[model samples]
Target: MKIKTKSKKVNKAWLHDHVTDPYVRLAQKEGYRARAAYKLKEIDEELHLLKPGQLVVDLGAAPGAWSQYVRRKFAPRDAAGGGAAVGALNGTVIALDLLDFEPIEGVHFIQGDFREEAVLAELQAAVNGRPVDVVISDMAPNLSGIEVSDAARIAHLVELAVEFSQQHLRPDGALVCKVFHGSGYSQLVDLFRSSFRTVKPIKPKASRDKSSETFLVGRGLKQQA
Candidate 1:
Protein backbone atom coordinates (compact mmCIF):
# COMPACT_ATOMS: atom_id res chain seq x y z
CA MET A 1 0.00 0.00 0.00
CA LYS A 2 2.81 2.38 0.80
CA ILE A 3 4.57 1.49 -2.45
CA LYS A 4 1.41 2.22 -4.40
CA THR A 5 1.17 5.62 -2.72
CA LYS A 6 4.75 6.42 -3.63
CA SER A 7 4.14 5.41 -7.26
CA LYS A 8 1.11 7.66 -7.37
CA LYS A 9 3.16 10.56 -6.11
CA VAL A 10 5.75 9.99 -8.80
CA ASN A 11 3.09 9.80 -11.47
CA LYS A 12 1.51 12.98 -10.22
CA ALA A 13 4.82 14.78 -10.24
CA TRP A 14 5.45 13.71 -13.83
CA LEU A 15 1.98 14.80 -14.85
CA HIS A 16 2.50 18.17 -13.23
CA ASP A 17 5.76 18.70 -15.03
CA HIS A 18 4.23 17.71 -18.35
CA VAL A 19 1.27 20.03 -17.97
CA THR A 20 3.49 22.97 -17.19
CA ASP A 21 6.05 22.26 -19.87
CA PRO A 22 6.36 25.11 -22.36
CA TYR A 23 6.65 22.82 -25.34
CA VAL A 24 3.50 21.00 -24.40
CA ARG A 25 1.54 24.23 -24.27
CA LEU A 26 3.06 25.36 -27.54
CA ALA A 27 2.15 22.08 -29.20
CA GLN A 28 -1.42 22.44 -28.05
CA LYS A 29 -1.65 25.98 -29.35
CA GLU A 30 -0.12 25.02 -32.70
CA GLY A 31 -2.22 21.90 -33.23
CA TYR A 32 0.71 19.51 -33.12
CA ARG A 33 -0.11 16.03 -31.81
CA ALA A 34 2.60 16.09 -29.16
CA ARG A 35 5.52 18.04 -27.69
CA ALA A 36 7.88 15.82 -29.66
CA ALA A 37 7.15 17.95 -32.71
CA TYR A 38 9.29 20.74 -31.22
CA LYS A 39 12.22 18.40 -30.86
CA LEU A 40 12.06 17.52 -34.56
CA LYS A 41 11.50 21.13 -35.46
CA GLU A 42 14.59 22.21 -33.57
CA ILE A 43 16.62 19.47 -35.19
CA ASP A 44 15.33 20.34 -38.64
CA GLU A 45 16.02 24.03 -38.22
CA GLU A 46 19.59 23.38 -37.21
CA LEU A 47 20.36 20.56 -39.65
CA HIS A 48 18.15 21.53 -42.57
CA LEU A 49 17.23 17.87 -42.77
CA LEU A 50 13.96 18.13 -44.68
CA LYS A 51 13.78 19.43 -48.23
CA PRO A 52 11.16 19.64 -50.91
CA GLY A 53 10.75 16.58 -53.12
CA GLN A 54 12.77 14.33 -50.84
CA LEU A 55 11.62 10.85 -49.81
CA VAL A 56 11.68 10.19 -46.05
CA VAL A 57 11.02 7.18 -43.89
CA ASP A 58 10.00 7.58 -40.24
CA LEU A 59 10.43 4.68 -37.86
CA GLY A 60 8.52 4.45 -34.58
CA ALA A 61 6.23 7.24 -35.69
CA ALA A 62 3.37 6.93 -33.27
CA PRO A 63 0.80 9.57 -32.37
CA GLY A 64 1.86 10.97 -35.76
CA ALA A 65 3.65 14.06 -34.38
CA TRP A 66 6.95 13.54 -36.18
CA SER A 67 5.10 12.66 -39.37
CA GLN A 68 2.95 15.72 -38.85
CA TYR A 69 6.04 17.94 -38.72
CA VAL A 70 7.44 16.37 -41.88
CA ARG A 71 4.15 16.70 -43.69
CA ARG A 72 3.86 20.38 -42.84
CA LYS A 73 7.42 21.07 -43.91
CA PHE A 74 7.02 19.45 -47.32
CA ALA A 75 3.41 20.34 -47.91
CA PRO A 76 3.11 22.33 -51.14
CA ARG A 77 2.35 25.99 -50.77
CA ASP A 78 1.15 28.49 -53.39
CA ALA A 79 4.25 30.61 -52.98
CA ALA A 80 6.38 27.66 -53.98
CA GLY A 81 4.22 27.02 -57.08
CA GLY A 82 4.12 23.36 -56.10
CA GLY A 83 1.17 20.96 -56.03
CA ALA A 84 -1.81 22.98 -54.82
CA ALA A 85 -3.33 20.50 -52.45
CA VAL A 86 -2.89 18.99 -49.03
CA GLY A 87 -0.66 15.85 -48.98
CA ALA A 88 0.60 17.14 -52.32
CA LEU A 89 3.99 17.85 -50.86
CA ASN A 90 6.74 17.38 -53.37
CA GLY A 91 7.94 14.66 -50.98
CA THR A 92 6.71 11.39 -49.50
CA VAL A 93 6.71 10.31 -45.83
CA ILE A 94 6.41 6.61 -44.99
CA ALA A 95 5.88 6.03 -41.27
CA LEU A 96 6.12 2.69 -39.46
CA ASP A 97 5.25 1.71 -35.90
CA LEU A 98 4.34 -1.32 -33.84
CA LEU A 99 1.26 0.40 -32.49
CA ASP A 100 -1.59 1.60 -34.67
CA PHE A 101 -1.39 5.34 -35.35
CA GLU A 102 -4.03 7.82 -36.25
CA PRO A 103 -3.74 9.04 -39.83
CA ILE A 104 -1.69 12.06 -40.67
CA GLU A 105 -2.08 14.15 -43.80
CA GLY A 106 0.33 13.25 -46.62
CA VAL A 107 1.88 10.34 -44.75
CA HIS A 108 1.79 6.63 -45.59
CA PHE A 109 1.62 4.58 -42.40
CA ILE A 110 2.71 0.96 -41.90
CA GLN A 111 1.50 -0.76 -38.76
CA GLY A 112 3.71 -3.62 -37.50
CA ASP A 113 6.84 -4.56 -35.61
CA PHE A 114 9.62 -2.98 -37.65
CA ARG A 115 12.08 -5.69 -36.65
CA GLU A 116 10.10 -8.26 -38.61
CA GLU A 117 11.24 -9.15 -42.12
CA ALA A 118 7.68 -8.97 -43.40
CA VAL A 119 7.27 -5.43 -42.15
CA LEU A 120 10.60 -4.41 -43.64
CA ALA A 121 9.52 -5.86 -46.98
CA GLU A 122 6.29 -3.90 -46.79
CA LEU A 123 8.21 -0.71 -46.09
CA GLN A 124 10.39 -1.38 -49.13
CA ALA A 125 7.32 -1.88 -51.27
CA ALA A 126 5.93 1.42 -50.06
CA VAL A 127 9.09 3.12 -51.26
CA ASN A 128 8.41 1.79 -54.77
CA GLY A 129 12.09 1.86 -55.77
CA ARG A 130 12.63 5.52 -54.97
CA PRO A 131 15.88 6.09 -53.14
CA VAL A 132 15.34 7.29 -49.61
CA ASP A 133 16.79 10.73 -48.91
CA VAL A 134 16.45 10.57 -45.15
CA VAL A 135 15.50 8.15 -42.40
CA ILE A 136 14.42 9.18 -38.92
CA SER A 137 13.80 6.87 -35.99
CA ASP A 138 12.29 7.93 -32.67
CA MET A 139 11.54 4.40 -31.64
CA ALA A 140 12.41 3.33 -28.12
CA PRO A 141 11.60 0.02 -26.55
CA ASN A 142 9.23 -0.12 -23.63
CA LEU A 143 11.38 0.27 -20.56
CA SER A 144 11.79 -2.67 -18.17
CA GLY A 145 13.03 -0.36 -15.36
CA ILE A 146 16.39 -2.09 -15.19
CA GLU A 147 19.11 0.21 -16.48
CA VAL A 148 21.22 -2.49 -18.14
CA SER A 149 18.27 -4.25 -19.70
CA ASP A 150 16.77 -0.99 -20.89
CA ALA A 151 20.03 0.16 -22.44
CA ALA A 152 20.44 -3.16 -24.21
CA ARG A 153 16.95 -2.95 -25.66
CA ILE A 154 17.58 0.63 -26.79
CA ALA A 155 20.87 -0.37 -28.39
CA HIS A 156 19.19 -3.20 -30.27
CA LEU A 157 16.62 -0.84 -31.72
CA VAL A 158 19.35 1.61 -32.69
CA GLU A 159 21.20 -1.19 -34.45
CA LEU A 160 18.12 -2.15 -36.39
CA ALA A 161 17.49 1.44 -37.39
CA VAL A 162 21.06 1.79 -38.60
CA GLU A 163 20.84 -1.45 -40.54
CA PHE A 164 17.63 -0.35 -42.18
CA SER A 165 19.19 2.99 -43.07
CA GLN A 166 22.18 1.28 -44.60
CA GLN A 167 19.96 -0.88 -46.74
CA HIS A 168 17.55 1.78 -47.99
CA LEU A 169 19.22 5.18 -47.83
CA ARG A 170 20.81 6.61 -50.94
CA PRO A 171 24.55 7.10 -51.06
CA ASP A 172 24.16 10.72 -49.97
CA GLY A 173 21.18 10.21 -47.70
CA ALA A 174 21.02 11.12 -44.02
CA LEU A 175 19.83 9.46 -40.82
CA VAL A 176 18.62 10.84 -37.51
CA CYS A 177 17.80 8.61 -34.57
CA LYS A 178 17.11 8.81 -30.87
CA VAL A 179 19.47 7.12 -28.44
CA PHE A 180 20.24 7.17 -24.76
CA HIS A 181 23.53 7.61 -22.97
CA GLY A 182 24.41 4.28 -21.41
CA SER A 183 25.88 0.90 -22.28
CA GLY A 184 26.53 0.34 -26.01
CA TYR A 185 26.28 4.07 -26.72
CA SER A 186 29.89 4.29 -27.85
CA GLN A 187 29.55 1.25 -30.06
CA LEU A 188 26.47 2.76 -31.68
CA VAL A 189 28.38 5.98 -32.29
CA ASP A 190 31.15 3.95 -33.86
CA LEU A 191 28.61 2.26 -36.10
CA PHE A 192 27.36 5.65 -37.25
CA ARG A 193 30.91 6.85 -37.83
CA SER A 194 31.63 3.86 -40.04
CA SER A 195 28.43 4.20 -42.04
CA PHE A 196 28.38 7.94 -42.55
CA ARG A 197 31.01 10.45 -43.58
CA THR A 198 29.90 12.97 -40.98
CA VAL A 199 28.26 12.13 -37.66
CA LYS A 200 26.87 14.67 -35.18
CA PRO A 201 25.19 14.25 -31.83
CA ILE A 202 22.53 16.73 -30.89
CA LYS A 203 20.28 17.32 -27.93
CA PRO A 204 17.51 19.61 -28.96
CA LYS A 205 16.35 22.34 -26.64
CA ALA A 206 12.91 20.86 -26.45
CA SER A 207 14.30 17.68 -25.01
CA ARG A 208 13.93 17.51 -21.27
CA ASP A 209 16.91 18.79 -19.32
CA LYS A 210 16.89 15.74 -17.06
CA SER A 211 16.70 13.18 -19.86
CA SER A 212 19.78 11.36 -21.05
CA GLU A 213 18.40 10.94 -24.56
CA THR A 214 20.28 12.43 -27.46
CA PHE A 215 19.94 12.33 -31.22
CA LEU A 216 22.60 11.23 -33.64
CA VAL A 217 22.51 12.77 -37.08
CA GLY A 218 24.50 11.03 -39.80
CA ARG A 219 25.02 12.43 -43.25
CA GLY A 220 26.67 11.31 -46.49
CA LEU A 221 26.63 7.54 -46.44
CA LYS A 222 29.98 6.05 -47.35
CA GLN A 223 30.13 3.80 -50.38
CA GLN A 224 32.23 0.65 -50.39
CA ALA A 225 35.50 1.19 -52.16
Candidate 2:
Protein backbone atom coordinates (compact mmCIF):
# COMPACT_ATOMS: atom_id res chain seq x y z
CA MET A 1 0.00 0.00 0.00
CA LYS A 2 0.94 3.66 -0.39
CA ILE A 3 1.19 4.12 3.38
CA LYS A 4 3.78 1.36 3.66
CA THR A 5 5.76 2.79 0.81
CA LYS A 6 5.72 6.23 2.41
CA SER A 7 6.94 4.79 5.71
CA LYS A 8 9.76 2.95 3.98
CA LYS A 9 10.84 6.09 2.19
CA VAL A 10 10.84 8.04 5.41
CA ASN A 11 12.93 5.39 7.10
CA LYS A 12 15.44 5.40 4.27
CA ALA A 13 15.76 9.17 4.39
CA TRP A 14 16.40 9.11 8.12
CA LEU A 15 18.99 6.40 7.73
CA HIS A 16 20.77 8.34 5.04
CA ASP A 17 20.79 11.49 7.09
CA HIS A 18 22.08 9.68 10.15
CA VAL A 19 24.91 8.17 8.15
CA THR A 20 25.96 11.56 6.81
CA ASP A 21 25.55 13.72 9.89
CA PRO A 22 28.85 15.28 10.95
CA TYR A 23 27.99 14.97 14.61
CA VAL A 24 27.35 11.26 14.25
CA ARG A 25 30.73 10.72 12.60
CA LEU A 26 32.42 12.86 15.21
CA ALA A 27 30.80 10.94 18.02
CA GLN A 28 32.03 7.70 16.57
CA LYS A 29 35.52 9.09 16.21
CA GLU A 30 35.52 10.49 19.76
CA GLY A 31 34.11 7.30 21.37
CA TYR A 32 30.91 8.94 22.58
CA ARG A 33 27.91 6.69 23.06
CA ALA A 34 25.78 8.74 20.67
CA ARG A 35 25.66 11.95 18.70
CA ALA A 36 23.53 13.48 21.43
CA ALA A 37 26.79 13.99 23.32
CA TYR A 38 27.47 16.94 21.01
CA LYS A 39 24.19 18.54 21.85
CA LEU A 40 25.06 18.51 25.57
CA LYS A 41 28.61 19.56 24.82
CA GLU A 42 27.43 22.62 22.95
CA ILE A 43 25.05 23.54 25.74
CA ASP A 44 27.70 23.04 28.42
CA GLU A 45 30.12 25.24 26.52
CA GLU A 46 27.61 28.05 26.66
CA LEU A 47 26.39 27.48 30.22
CA HIS A 48 29.36 25.87 32.00
CA LEU A 49 26.94 23.52 33.74
CA LEU A 50 29.45 20.87 34.73
CA LYS A 51 31.97 21.72 37.40
CA PRO A 52 34.51 20.02 39.63
CA GLY A 53 33.05 18.32 42.73
CA GLN A 54 29.42 18.73 41.77
CA LEU A 55 26.80 16.11 42.55
CA VAL A 56 24.67 15.60 39.47
CA VAL A 57 21.49 13.68 38.75
CA ASP A 58 20.70 12.74 35.17
CA LEU A 59 17.10 11.86 34.47
CA GLY A 60 16.27 9.67 31.46
CA ALA A 61 19.96 9.05 31.03
CA ALA A 62 19.74 6.02 28.73
CA PRO A 63 22.46 5.55 26.17
CA GLY A 64 24.41 7.73 28.65
CA ALA A 65 26.35 9.95 26.30
CA TRP A 66 25.57 12.93 28.50
CA SER A 67 26.82 11.11 31.58
CA GLN A 68 29.90 10.01 29.69
CA TYR A 69 30.66 13.59 28.77
CA VAL A 70 30.12 14.68 32.33
CA ARG A 71 32.46 12.00 33.58
CA ARG A 72 35.22 12.95 31.17
CA LYS A 73 34.84 16.63 31.92
CA PHE A 74 34.39 16.60 35.69
CA ALA A 75 35.49 13.21 36.89
CA PRO A 76 38.21 13.40 39.49
CA ARG A 77 41.68 13.01 38.09
CA ASP A 78 44.79 11.72 39.80
CA ALA A 79 47.04 14.18 41.60
CA ALA A 80 48.76 14.79 38.27
CA GLY A 81 45.43 15.44 36.53
CA GLY A 82 46.66 13.35 33.62
CA GLY A 83 44.62 10.16 33.60
CA ALA A 84 41.00 9.60 32.38
CA ALA A 85 40.05 7.09 35.05
CA VAL A 86 36.41 7.24 36.22
CA GLY A 87 36.36 6.17 39.88
CA ALA A 88 38.88 8.80 40.84
CA LEU A 89 36.72 11.59 39.44
CA ASN A 90 36.06 14.56 41.72
CA GLY A 91 32.28 14.47 41.29
CA THR A 92 29.37 12.05 41.44
CA VAL A 93 26.81 11.29 38.72
CA ILE A 94 23.63 9.31 39.33
CA ALA A 95 21.78 8.46 36.13
CA LEU A 96 18.22 7.12 35.93
CA ASP A 97 16.21 5.75 33.02
CA LEU A 98 13.40 3.41 32.01
CA LEU A 99 15.59 1.51 29.58
CA ASP A 100 18.82 -0.36 30.20
CA PHE A 101 22.05 1.35 29.23
CA GLU A 102 25.57 0.04 29.05
CA PRO A 103 27.53 1.10 32.11
CA ILE A 104 29.73 4.16 32.05
CA GLU A 105 32.94 4.21 34.03
CA GLY A 106 32.20 6.95 36.55
CA VAL A 107 28.41 6.96 36.48
CA HIS A 108 26.01 5.20 38.84
CA PHE A 109 22.94 4.17 36.86
CA ILE A 110 19.45 3.28 38.11
CA GLN A 111 16.81 1.70 35.90
CA GLY A 112 13.18 2.63 36.58
CA ASP A 113 10.35 4.90 35.54
CA PHE A 114 11.17 8.33 36.93
CA ARG A 115 7.49 9.11 37.43
CA GLU A 116 7.07 6.66 40.27
CA GLU A 117 7.51 7.55 43.95
CA ALA A 118 9.54 4.42 44.65
CA VAL A 119 12.00 5.30 41.95
CA LEU A 120 12.25 8.84 43.18
CA ALA A 121 12.92 7.58 46.66
CA GLU A 122 15.60 5.28 45.38
CA LEU A 123 17.20 8.13 43.48
CA GLN A 124 17.16 10.27 46.58
CA ALA A 125 18.66 7.47 48.65
CA ALA A 126 21.40 7.10 46.10
CA VAL A 127 22.23 10.73 46.61
CA ASN A 128 22.64 9.81 50.27
CA GLY A 129 21.74 13.26 51.64
CA ARG A 130 24.23 15.07 49.45
CA PRO A 131 23.14 18.39 48.04
CA VAL A 132 22.66 18.03 44.31
CA ASP A 133 24.48 20.71 42.42
CA VAL A 134 22.91 20.03 39.03
CA VAL A 135 20.01 18.01 37.61
CA ILE A 136 19.70 17.30 33.90
CA SER A 137 16.82 15.56 32.17
CA ASP A 138 16.60 14.46 28.55
CA MET A 139 13.54 12.30 28.89
CA ALA A 140 10.93 12.00 26.12
CA PRO A 141 7.88 9.82 26.25
CA ASN A 142 7.12 7.32 23.52
CA LEU A 143 5.10 9.09 20.87
CA SER A 144 1.56 7.87 20.23
CA GLY A 145 1.43 9.56 16.80
CA ILE A 146 -0.93 12.15 18.28
CA GLU A 147 0.75 15.51 18.59
CA VAL A 148 -1.32 16.82 21.48
CA SER A 149 -1.02 13.62 23.45
CA ASP A 150 2.69 13.43 22.86
CA ALA A 151 3.14 17.01 24.00
CA ALA A 152 1.25 16.35 27.22
CA ARG A 153 3.28 13.27 28.00
CA ILE A 154 6.58 15.08 27.50
CA ALA A 155 5.35 18.02 29.53
CA HIS A 156 4.53 15.77 32.46
CA LEU A 157 8.07 14.40 32.46
CA VAL A 158 9.48 17.91 32.36
CA GLU A 159 7.30 18.94 35.25
CA LEU A 160 8.50 15.99 37.27
CA ALA A 161 12.10 16.93 36.61
CA VAL A 162 11.42 20.50 37.62
CA GLU A 163 9.70 19.46 40.81
CA PHE A 164 12.52 17.12 41.68
CA SER A 165 15.04 19.87 41.16
CA GLN A 166 13.06 22.22 43.34
CA GLN A 167 13.09 19.75 46.16
CA HIS A 168 16.59 18.31 45.88
CA LEU A 169 18.90 20.87 44.30
CA ARG A 170 21.08 23.12 46.36
CA PRO A 171 19.83 26.70 46.65
CA ASP A 172 22.42 27.86 44.13
CA GLY A 173 22.24 24.77 41.94
CA ALA A 174 21.10 24.50 38.35
CA LEU A 175 18.76 22.37 36.25
CA VAL A 176 19.08 21.60 32.54
CA CYS A 177 16.24 19.80 30.84
CA LYS A 178 15.16 19.02 27.27
CA VAL A 179 11.71 20.29 26.34
CA PHE A 180 9.67 20.72 23.18
CA HIS A 181 8.35 24.08 22.10
CA GLY A 182 4.61 23.55 21.79
CA SER A 183 1.40 23.33 23.79
CA GLY A 184 2.61 23.22 27.41
CA TYR A 185 5.88 24.98 26.62
CA SER A 186 4.93 28.39 27.96
CA GLN A 187 3.64 26.98 31.20
CA LEU A 188 6.87 25.09 31.71
CA VAL A 189 8.85 28.27 31.17
CA ASP A 190 6.65 30.06 33.65
CA LEU A 191 7.20 27.29 36.14
CA PHE A 192 10.96 27.60 35.79
CA ARG A 193 10.79 31.40 36.06
CA SER A 194 8.83 31.10 39.26
CA SER A 195 11.27 28.68 40.85
CA PHE A 196 14.67 29.94 39.76
CA ARG A 197 16.42 33.29 39.70
CA THR A 198 17.29 32.85 36.02
CA VAL A 199 15.81 30.70 33.27
CA LYS A 200 17.26 30.55 29.78
CA PRO A 201 16.30 28.49 26.74
CA ILE A 202 19.01 26.98 24.54
CA LYS A 203 18.83 25.24 21.18
CA PRO A 204 22.14 23.55 20.57
CA LYS A 205 23.62 23.31 17.10
CA ALA A 206 23.71 19.51 17.25
CA SER A 207 19.94 19.38 17.63
CA ARG A 208 18.12 18.65 14.39
CA ASP A 209 16.99 21.81 12.59
CA LYS A 210 13.47 20.50 12.07
CA SER A 211 13.01 19.42 15.68
CA SER A 212 11.17 21.68 18.09
CA GLU A 213 13.24 20.47 21.05
CA THR A 214 15.12 22.97 23.18
CA PHE A 215 17.01 22.95 26.48
CA LEU A 216 15.85 25.00 29.42
CA VAL A 217 18.47 25.97 31.96
CA GLY A 218 17.22 27.06 35.37
CA ARG A 219 19.79 28.49 37.72
CA GLY A 220 19.80 29.74 41.32
CA LEU A 221 16.78 28.31 42.99
CA LYS A 222 14.91 30.93 44.99
CA GLN A 223 14.68 30.42 48.72
CA GLN A 224 11.16 29.70 49.90
CA ALA A 225 9.82 32.42 52.14
* Angstrom error at residue 3, model 1: 1.6
- TM-score for each of the candidates: 0.94, 0.94
lDDT of 2 by residue, 27-81 (tens): 9988888999998889888989888789999999999998988888775555457
151-185 per-residue lDDT for model 1 (tens digits)? 88998898898888888899889999999988888
lDDT of residue 127 for candidate 1 = 90
Once superposed on the true structure, which residue ranges of model 2 sit more than 4 Å away at CA?
76-87
Q: How many times do residue backbones clash in model 1?
A: 0
lDDT against the true structure, per candidate, is 0.89, 0.89
lDDT of 1: 0.89
